[model samples]
Target chain A: MLGYTLRRILQMIPVLLGATFIIYALTFLMPGDPIAALTGERPLPEATVAQIRQAYHLDDPFFVQYGNYILGVFRGDFGIDFFGRPVLDLILERLPVTFALAVTAWGLKLVIGLVIGVYGGLRAGKAADHFALVFTVLFMGIPGFVIALGGQTYFGVHLGWVDPAGIRAGWPMAFILPALVMALEAAAGLARLTRTSLVDVLRAEYLRTAKAKGLSPQRIIWGHALRNAMIPVVTYLGLSLAGMLGGAVIIEAIFNLPGIGGLMVASINNKEGTVVVGIATLLVLVYLVFNLLVDLTYGLIDPRVRI
Target chain B: MTQLLEVRDLRVQFSTAQGTATAINGVNLSLEHGQSLGILGESGSGKSVTARTIMGLLDMPPAKINGGEILLEGEDLLTATAKRRRQLTGPVMSMVFQDALSALNPVHPVGRQIGELYRVHRGYSRKAAKAAAIEMMDRVRIPAAASRVNDYPHQFSGGMRQRIVIAMALALDPQLLIADEPTTALDVTVQAQILELLKEQQAENNMGLILITHDISVVREVTDQVAVMYAGRIVEQGPTAHVLGDPRHPYTLGLSQSVANEDLKGRRLPAIEGSPPDLLALPRGCSFANRCPLADEQCSSSAPPLESVGAGRTSACFHSGKVASNVAYSN
Candidate 1:
């Protein structure tokens, strides 16, 4: 098990490098001189521009500049952004808020999806199954921002449930609307996955034995069927960390929450390459860690999966 | 002897997009305590369906019980409430399946799988259930039951896994145990061992055992009574020795001929001609009429009822007497 984990960690290095390299390369394609954008309207002297370019190694070849950035990332030295503030520090400050939204959304998604999915699976080809099918299709087709905007319009501005936009720190209520919108799409996908997996599991031969043993339908489903069904659901949920992060970008924008996703968009517009690259690197690392955790959990859930 | 189970005119049909197909036709069967009955049939002859319907395990939308009276000790199970049937399942009756590997849950320990009955029905604590499960593993002759109880289904060999299935079935001391081709998925040597285990366990528990198999030799070895099924109906049923020794129906006679004999190896082996009739479009007269060499105009015109042929035997053939005399003369 330890050897497997070590190998996975080793495999993650090249992927991280590739991801950071892509983010670094994308910055160059942003169609503007980042230094001029940083100075913005108050045009700086040519000497000052030269000085700034030299200090940041902007005068070097593209490959050389990327190499320096990679080294700086390894040293935890993400360079200054357009505002001359450390990109790493800025990202770190927003990390907690994004984490809160993501976790809440994910937790809700799993709980709701599993319950509804199991119901649909148990009653496959019946009323509950049809209802779940229609519900999933509707939710999955609609965008999270539409749901967010609708929620804010109805529950926020009209009903005075909370603010129409923006979030307050340490306030659980402020997190509700955005988290719910983010969770809707994820929950729909998970429910569909869960329903399909469980429907298959219910048809397995072991389930026949379970039924023949005189086990209550309830026990048979929860005990034998769900345990086996959970493998695929776990796989989807683990991989969904990346998906939730993407959703959070749209969700954070809609609600005006100060999360890493919101920060990312602002950085993208300003052509702050350091901030974009730094956040992208951190996301890749989070993705790798989540995948590792999922693999380990597979061993715990299913004895057939050897460490 | 007390009747443990009885099925009267039980019919099961599967409704499909094409049409409804009869899986089991007007079948009648009964079992007494401490007796072993073998249901012998080829594939699609409703052997497994009979067992599943008896267990109340068939899903009802695709599968519908058109008509039936499944009685457990004179209690009609078909009309019984779901709760009542469920209550009787583990304690009164249980079933073992054909494929041992698929029958056992791959994720859970074999012992826990066995112990599930005790935990759910008897309300035993987890530790207590584990101990009882180990005892059952020992009873089924699994080596190192104490340690091996924690092992998963894939960890055990085929024969050993079948033994585990038997252990689970016998755990609740059910009055009736249905083994649907229990040894079908095993090797010849392993098949014999699993059969032996089942026979021993049945004898010990004094349970009514219904062993379903296509192998005539398996039925000969393990059962006291035997029923030969042809196209969802029992064509011949009586004592196993009597039925095999003197088959009255052409279908049963045909089945007996297919059993390979070492002495007849150099010659052409006798085989029944034609395939089983299609279930969706069976002839009004008899399903097996086309396949029977002895089938005459009367056989094709109308189906023959299962009639008593004296000596506690029944045969569903109009020329049963003629077939019997000819078979007796040959023997």
Candidate 2:
């Protein structure tokens, strides 16, 4: 198991490099000069531009610039943005907010998804099952931005539940509504997947054996069926966690949470390649780690699966 | 004293997309203590359904008992409360299913599965149940039961897994054990081993065993009495040797001929022509009329009732006298 984990971690290096390279290349290909954009109204003089370009190695080819950036990254340097602020510091500042948001959304998704999914699966072809199906379809059908806008209007403008936007009101209060909005689509998908998986597991022949052994219906479902059903649900939840941690740019924009997502968008618009590439690198690491965790979790849930 | 089990006019039906399909049609059976009865049939002949219905394992709504009384030592299980039935299961009666790989829960250790009976029915402690599980495993003849107790179902071979299932079913030493095609998924040699184990367990516990299977040789090897089923009804029933030796019903005669034998080498074995009748829209007359060579107007006009043809034997056929004479000509 230790060897497997080590190999998985080792495999992440190439993936991380590839992801960072793509983000850097895309940012580099964007039109307009960062230094020129920095001095928007009054353009910088030729000599000052040259000095800044020489210092930042902006005139070098893409490969040379990428090589320099990678070398700096190995030494824990993420370079600087157009505003002369260290990109690593900028990412670190927003890390906690994004972490809190992602965790909240992930928790909400799991609880809501599992509860509704299991309920629906157990009562399949009945009213509860129909309700779950409709609920999932409705949520899944609507786009994320539309849901965010509608939530803002209903909860913020009409009901006065809490502040419509921004994190000024504090940790949980500000996070709940946006996190819920962020959680909706993925939760719907998770609930549907859970329902399908659970329904299939419930009908498995082993469950009949459990019943024949004279186990009560409750024990049959909870003890035997749920563990097997959880295999696929766990996989789905892990992937969604990785996705949530990658950040929801639209939700962050609408709710105005100063998260990594918002930072990423603002940096891209300003052509701050260092900040964008840094955030992308962090997301790549998160994805790889969660994937490894999911694979490891499979071995634990099902003894048949060896690491 | 009451028999170990008695199923009188037991009827089972399934509501399918087409219509209500009568899977088990007025089947009657009785087993004495320590006796083994084999229910012989082809696929979809309701042998498995009968065993499952007896175990109360069939899912209702899709499957419903139209009319029946399953008496376990004089108590009508059909009238028993759901909780009462549950209490009876594992302690009073239990079942072993086909496909042992699917029958045993994959995630749990084989020992835990076997031990679950003691834990649930006997209220044994976890440690006690584990010890009992190892003991049951040893009884079923699983090698190194103590060491292999923690291994999951997937870790075991097919035959060994079936042994684990048997150990679990017999854990509480229930009066009745319904094994539905238990050896169907095993190798020929492995099948013999499982049968031997079952026979040994039955004798040791003096348990009434109902072996449901399509294999004639298996039934002959394991059971004392036999009931040949066709279209969900018992067409012929008597002592295993008597029924197999002189099959009174045309269907039973056909089934006996279908088995491969040394004398029939290089000769075309006579198989029962046509498939079993569809449960939905069954003909008013005999279900086997279409497939029987002796099917006449009388056989087609009305279904034959099961009647005594000889000592301790019953055959559901209008022309039982001719069945024996016709068997020689078929050869």
Over A1-307, each residue of candidate 2 has an lDDT whose tens digit, in order, gives 9999999899988987888898889989999888877778998889999998998889999999999998888788988887688889999999898889898999998988888899999999999999999998898999888999999999998998989999999889998898898788778888888889999998999999998888999999999999999988888888889899865666888999999989988888777788889988888878889999999888788899966
Per-residue lDDT of candidate 2, residues B1-331 (tens digit): 8899999999999999999999999999999999999999999999989998999988998999999899999999999998999999999899988999999888899889988889899899999999999999998989999999999999999999999999989999999999999999999999999999999999989999999999999999999999999989999999999999999999888888888889899998877778888899888999999988888999999999999989999999999988988744254
Error of 1 at B261 (Å): 1.9
lDDT of 1 at B7: 96
Q: Specify the CAPRI tier of model 2.
A: high
Please give the distance, in angstroms, between residue B315's alpha carbon in candidate 2 and its true position after superposition: 0.5
Q: Indicate the residue-level lDDT of A239 in model 1.
A: 82
Best by DockQ: 2
Each candidate structure's TM-score, on Cα atoms with residue i matched to residue i, is 0.96, 0.98
Candidate 1's residue-wise lDDT over A1-307, tens digit each? 8899999999998998998888889886789887778778899999999988898788899899999998988898988875678988898999888888888888888887888888898888899899999998898999777888999999899998888778763557888878887788789889988999998998999999998888888888889999899988988899897667767877888888899989999888877888888888888888889888898888788898866
**Model 1, residue B294: displacement in angstroms?**
1.1
Worst 10 residues of 1 chain B by lDDT: B322-331
Model 1 Cα lDDT, one tens digit per residue, B1-331: 4479999999999998999889999999999999999999999999999999999889887899999799998899999998888889888999998998998998999989999999988999999999999999999899999999899998889899999999999999999999999988899999988989889989988999999999999999999999999888998999999999888898888888877799668767788878999888778887788977677899899999999986889999988988855532121
DockQ, cand. 2: 0.90
Stretches of candidate 2 off by over 4 Å are B328-331
